[model samples]
Target: MSDTFFAYLVTLAYGDKETPTLAQVVFLSENEAEDTRTVARALLQNAKQTAPEKTRFDWSTLKVHGSQSLSDDELMGLVAAAAQGQVGVGRVSTLKLS
Candidate 1:
């Protein structure tokens, strides 16, 4: 049987604002996803140092929009889109299967 993977859709806010300005999708085990979220939160503490001044990403706004199980093919497409830099600043976990 193939291993099951969970996809987490995360959005990062640049400042103390409530709205998110950036989005990223991460695929991993449930536990790993939780751990990654923690790390993301820690990174937010240094957002100013990490992101350029022109890019307004409020680290305090980081959040997990949602999560779901992804089939192998769907996961592959996400990987492909990430490789091609086509994800942009939007949701990627919901891409339809072709």
Candidate 2:
């Protein structure tokens, strides 16, 4: 059996003030989570290049939410059930095997 793990999708934003104006998060595979973070950082850098001269990019934040664990078979079953309208979005959750 494959070892189970947790992955989180984090959104980072920049702003001049102490407070952040935007935030979002999601669950993904471990590799996907890292890829998402890398992409966000690159996008932020690109924005700074074209942003106004005085734009202050001072604050960055990351938030994680939602947790569940499912094996490959469990995930497939969930997908199949959704196709048949036997389950809804509320039933979707992470799956981890000990």
Candidate 3:
């Protein structure tokens, strides 16, 4: 079976719905889907602490499995949070598993 990857831009906050600081998670082509999703969530959670509440930190055009996962509401929130320098996304990960 094929694998998937998820790039995260986590917020430097405690809230699950909070903006991200600057993090990403990549799903390996050789990893299980369930495991990859878990890794993505965790990475986002970890990146939250680095966000400052403003900056162009919102994740955009990020190649991954679930851009749709970032719903319209969520995107709006991310934009607002990023405008306030809440977080920043930088240096995406290159997850590879074979």
**Candidate topping TM-score:** 3
lDDT of 1 by residue, 1-98 (tens): 33443444444232223553343443223233344344343333323245223222232223333434446675444435434433333322322222
lDDT of 2 at 48: 40
Tens digit of lDDT per residue, candidate 3, span 5-96? 43333323312445423333232223233343343343345345442222122345432333334566765565456445453433334434
Computed on alpha carbons, the lDDT of every model, listed in order, comes to 0.36, 0.34, 0.38
- Per-residue alpha-carbon lDDT of model 2 for 78-97, expressed as tens digits? 33442443321211133342
Query: Model 3 off-target regions past 4 Å?
Result: 1-68, 92-98
Clashing pairs in 2: 68-94, 68-95, 69-94, 69-95, 69-96, 70-95
**Model 2 CA deviation exceeding 4 Å by range:** 1-66, 90-98
Best by lDDT: 3
Q: Which ten residues in a row have the lowest lDDT in candidate 2?
A: 55-64
Which model, 1 or 3, shows the larger lDDT? 3
Task: Please give the ranking of all candidate structures by TM-score, highest first, separated by commas.
Answer: 3, 1, 2
